[model samples]
Target chain A: MEVNEYNACVREWADALFRFACKCTGQASDAHDVVQNSFEVLWQKRKEVETGKAKAYLFQVAYRKSIDHYRKKVKITFAAPPEETYTPANPDLKKILDRALAQLDDQARALVLLKDYEGYRYEEIAQITDLTETQVKVYLHRARKILKEYLVSVENII
Target chain B: MISWENYEEYMMMHADGELKPAEAQELMAFLDANPTLKSEMALYDLTRLTPDESLTYHDKNSLLKPEPVKRVISFPKWRKYAIAAGIALLVFVSLFKYIDTNKNNARIAKTDTTKPIIPEPANNTSNKNEPQPQQEPKSIAATTVQPAKVTHATHHDIHPQITHNKQLANTKQNDNALVNNITPAAKATTEISSLPITTTKPLPSEIAMASPPMATIPAYEITPPAKPTKRSLIDRLPIDEANKRQLKTIAHITSGASRSVSKVKEEIDGNAITFNIKNNNIHISF
Candidate 1:
């Protein structure tokens, strides 16, 4: 991709990539880092990428960076109790949804983000997450089941 | 195909908008038949996350790159070579002109120094018939004598007296007889006879010194000098005192050889060798 096309990708897809990173990483700061790193990788690989594929390329980079960040966070804080991880001052629907997204693993969360947030097809998500289409469909369905269960839970729904 | 075992997959695909329209209708019909599963499908619909429009990357300007600059002018290979060749030719022509100018200046200086300066004679006597007394031949140092005011004289006009005296000296048997004929007054008059004589009027003193019979002396002609030539310029250059001594020594040697040669030739064929020291010319009678 040329510079202007890469920059156009940034303008069109940066917010969506950031939201996907935010949902996968579960922290605004980590999401910013993931977004920044994803664009940096895209810029570095601009010559190899085409303008049509730049959005997918960016999401792929952000998905990998988020997985790495999530792994590092898990390794460092493995002893911490899951109940103490999120303490929302005011629990709204968006905060409840965030807590439910945090319950899924990094890969499942990225699959959900690519599916719902970016509206990528199963095949495109499989390409970005480097999984087979069947794996993506199974993982995304499982994630949706977990989110449905969390929303129906009486304590969490309130 | 929509059964309880595979019902959740249809719900997820329907929520993701991946199901075909007929399958979506089939799932809705199956949900209508199973009234309790209708609420389960609604919960699946809630799983689709709507992107918050307020969420944005604030630092997106940093990712943009500037456009590449365009070149204003470019030269072809032939044009560059032509420019270089033109510069080289201009320098070569300038150097050649500079060298040629220097050579011309040097040639002018050399010509000025070697040019002969012909001057008029002090005594303008040009009497051709009178036998003038011969002057004692001076060394080459006498060449530096100051020139007279008159600008030019031919060899015949200037040296008529010398030619007459030479013929007389040739006829006499003894050199002392020729020396006795040169009176003291004539000797004084001919002191600077090395200079050309241009005047045609005869002096009273020369008429008195003409005691020898003019009829006995064979008439000889001296050629006149024309415009100065290269040989004349070389002859006019001043010789140093040392060079004059060397030339005198060479002249003495040559004179001795000439005397011996004269005697031998006179005995064999009545011909003689005559050497003139004043002008460095050798005459041979054959």
Candidate 2:
């Protein structure tokens, strides 16, 4: 891909990648950093990426960066928040949804987000997440079951 | 064909639109049988995380414009070496020019002795504080110190320092001749350093005269302390000053008949050594 094609990728995919990263990382700053790092990786390997697979390539990098960032944040939370260690009940639908998403482990949450938000196929998600197609299906199914159970608590859901 | 355990797989496939039409119809029949589980479809909504209307991409379109490329310039290693070498050459040239200028200045200062500094053509050519070494042959004092007394001593056992006076006399024969001409006394009383003519500094007018008498009085006082050894008897001889020069002879003589004689015989330029110890006489000549 050329510079213009990369710029087009940035313009078209930055928002989607940023949204996926934000949901995965639970922070705007971390999501922004993830998007920036993903795009930088894309720019470095632009020569190797096919023009048709730019979105997958971008999400692939962003997905990996988000997983790493999520692990680091989880480690930091464990180190810093001894007093606020208990999970407070979040009533708002959006906060509850975020909490439900946060409850999923890294690969399961990434699997569900790649499937639902980005509409990536099982094979494409497996390629992006570096997993087998069957593994993606099983993990996504588990993540959805968790989300359904969390939402079932509310009588009138948003 | 789907069992209760496979119901989740079917529902997930239905939610993902991956279920066949027949499987979808079966999944809807199962959901109709369990109406309370219908709200579980909320997983579909919960899974989709669309960006909020308030959220933006932090102006990603601005990134399409190229960032400015920074250029860094640096000098190479060879350039630094060249600069250092040029400075060294410049310093070397400046030092050379400075030394050459000093040499030229000293030469100009020396040759400026144009007039006859000593109006009477005196023995001391040390006027103007510059030694005039060239006015030796024609000076009145130049006729005194003989060439034989000033020949260089080359004996193997001789000390370089004791024989150094003969070397100085040979090199400055013109000045030394002036020293010898100061008195015909040729006396052992006056040492070479006590010469009145070579006194470069001021002295008392009476003692400064060409008077060996006062000098001989001190020599007489110092005589008792002198041992009467064979070296001293030779030292008392007037010809002792020539010992530093080429030895003319060593005569060892006795009135008795000859017992034995040991001589170092080497012939060079008519120099010879004759040891006649039987008569207690030894002659070594150069």
Candidate 3:
């Protein structure tokens, strides 16, 4: 894609990338860093990227950066507050839901985001997650089942 | 009325949104009969639709922002090495020249005289001359009448006074022969002896007298002074009276040798006036 076109796409897609990074790290600052780093990588290798495939390329970089951020977090053993902590809770449902989401493994959570939040097809999720399509379907199914069970438990407790 | 085999296909198709209206109707018919499975499907749909509070997603467009990369520049290996080597070579050459020039100058300044400039008067003129037949009359006239004038400057390794006495004899000889005859021996003695014993300054005539003394001293000292015609010859002379004895002795022996060789069959000629005379030794030329 032309640089201007690529830039427009980045502007359009930055929120979504931030959201994904926010999901992965559960911290806005870490999400911002991951998204920023991914874009930098994309800009560096933009010439090699196909115009139609730039979106996929960008997601791939962001996903990698997000994973790296978590890995580093784990290595350093830093404890970050859940994303919903910033929301002043009228009912505290958001905080409860966020705590439940954070409890999921990194891969399972990424699969859930790719499937439900981004509306990626099973095949595209598999490509992004480097899993088989069947695996992607199975994982998404399981992730949803787990979320349903956890949310029900949380609601009952509330 | 829905069999378990049909139930799996029904739920799978519903989840995928791929059910035909009739197939969906059949699934609903099955679900309405099996209420437990219906609740499960409803629950799954709700779970899928509900927003994840903790999660935020970024699309590719959002993730790609431009940043600048800095490049590192470096100098080439061979060029740097060549420059270093050139500087080292220049320093080495300059230092070598400095040491060699200083050593050479010092060696030249302290040099002693071993080389000789042999007086080759025979080379200048080829002639046979005899001594005057009235040798006694000449001696009586030269030595007795001018005892203070005829001086023979003879220097021995032991004493300088001997050379001074010989110089007195040369003055006496010249006193009888010609009042104006400037005998080098008498001139040097008279000029040197006239100066205060401790004074270092030499009269102009003494300087002239000292020139011949340098010739007798040695050949090595002659090379440096050879370039400056006036100062070189005189400069080679001993600066101190103490060293003059050695110089005069060397001169006396050299002049004596020349006189003996040239004295055979000498007759009185205007140009043949003898400058060298020792006991029973005379040189004559025409």
- The best candidate by lDDT is 1
Question: Mind giving the per-residue lDDT tens digits that candidate 1 earns over B174-222?
Answer: 4435545789886554433323333222233443444254224333122
- How would you encode candidate 3's per-residue C-alpha lDDT over B69-154 as one tens digit per residue? 56887779998899899999999999999999999987876552332222222111211131212122221122222223223211
TM value for model 2: 0.44
B242 Cα displacement, candidate 3 (Å): 99
Number of the top DockQ candidate: 1
| Model 2 chain A: ten consecutive residues of lowest lDDT | A77-86
Write the residue-wise lDDT of candidate 2 on A1-158 in tens digits.
Answer: 88878988898888888888777776788888888888888888989998899899988888889778866664533111121211325334555566667768877877777877777788988899889999888888788777767666543442
**Model 3: residue B132 alpha-carbon error in angstroms:** 99
Give the TM-score (vs. native) of candidate 1: 0.47
C-alpha-based local distance difference test score of model 1: 0.70
lDDT for A13 (candidate 2): 85
Least accurate stretch of 10 residues (summed lDDT) in model 1 chain B?
A: B134-143
- Model 2 stretches with alpha carbons more than 4 Å out: A74-95, A156-158, B33-53, B65-286
**Per-residue accuracy of model 3 over A1-158 as CA lDDT, tens digit each:** 56776787686667677777777777778887887787787777878887777777767777878777777664422234444322225545545545656667777778777665677777887788778998876776666667667766654555
